[model samples]
Target: MGTKESDGVDPRVLRTRRDVVDAATELFVTEGWSVVTHAEVARRAGYSKATVYAHWPTRLDLMRASIGKICDEADHPEPTGDLRADLVRGLVDFAEDLAGGHLDRVLGGLLERSGSDPVVDELRRRLYEAGTRSLEGVLRSHLPEVDVEPSLALLVGGVLTRGAFQGRPATEEFVADLVDRVLASTGRGEEG
Candidate 1:
């Protein structure tokens, strides 16, 4: 007999996990963290609550799995070695994500409950790292080692403020200008 691909685990179990996690992630992205419950996820995934509870055991567990999936699926533009262009592209993409409402919902929930628990704190950190991994790479390549974090903060913070805080569109021109300002302040504008 042929062995199963999932290390001898039944395919049904794997399917259940995928379905449950996918449902949880969709709920998180659309409705915020507070709405992701075992009951809701079970209904959305067409599985019983017992099945979800068996796999996840808690709301935090579901959030962790969903955030992990989000990080794993994060997509960013390819860096072409042009610092200004790359920064502009990255920021623009980030703005779009915020505008799409998915990021804002998840971020709003995380920020609303920041520091209430160690697990929540870890999830927040993971989400930030995932969201900024691309921009961090670009900054690290061109800026001084000491400046990467601040520059990343400035770039990402600017977009977040403009799009999520101010409730305005972070236009391409705005992002490009923001990138130019940061790069100029760091003495790396256009040249590196």
Candidate 2:
């Protein structure tokens, strides 16, 4: 195990850390990260504050680790040649929580913690880069006829984020409409 490996951090430490993150995700989704305390997370995880501290020295670390887990769960845009389908799949995955106001709440709490926490921006950048690559792959596949800029992958991501902002939930029907729009815009429609 390398220094970066979680396994190297002691089995007890890893378990305790995972517990904190799991508890924080559950609590943050409901109580919002702003109000969630280490003590609360520790209690929920059936651990002590000192144990939580043993893994996460500060609240930001706990928040970032938890968000990182969520972001990892959201990694999508499976490498199907049909970018339209891939984008739709990714959107559905990313926007489900958005439409239900989960994304807004999650981002709101994260942004508050990140305002002064340097780790937030760094972690967010990493997550954004990862998500952007997934979207770009889909867009290039769907828009092969057009010049696709990888940087513009954000457009596809934004569409879903915008849906979340527009108060749309990740419903099968709404996802279908989004898929239609994405396919049509990307020249994946029948005409294309």
Off by over 4 Å in 1: 1-8
TM-score of each: 0.93, 0.73
State the TM-score for model 2: 0.73
lDDT tens digits, residue span 118-178, model 2: 6777766665665566766666655667766532544445555667555544565666566
Segments in model 2 whose C-alpha atoms lie over 4 Å from true places: 1-4, 75-77, 113-115, 141-162, 169-192
Instruction: Please provide, for model 1 over 4-82, each residue's C-alpha lDDT reduced to its tens digit, 9 standing for 90 to 100.
Output: 4358787899899889989999999998888999999999999999999999999989998898888878897789999
User: How many angstroms is residue 71 displaced in model 2 relative to the true structure, after the best TM-score fit?
Assistant: 2.8
Q: For model 1, how big is the CA root-mean-square deviation?
A: 3.4
lDDT of each: 0.88, 0.67
**Best TM-score among the predictions, by candidate number:** 1
Candidate 2 weakest ten by summed lDDT: 150-159
Task: Give candidate 1's error at residue 98 in angstroms.
Answer: 0.6
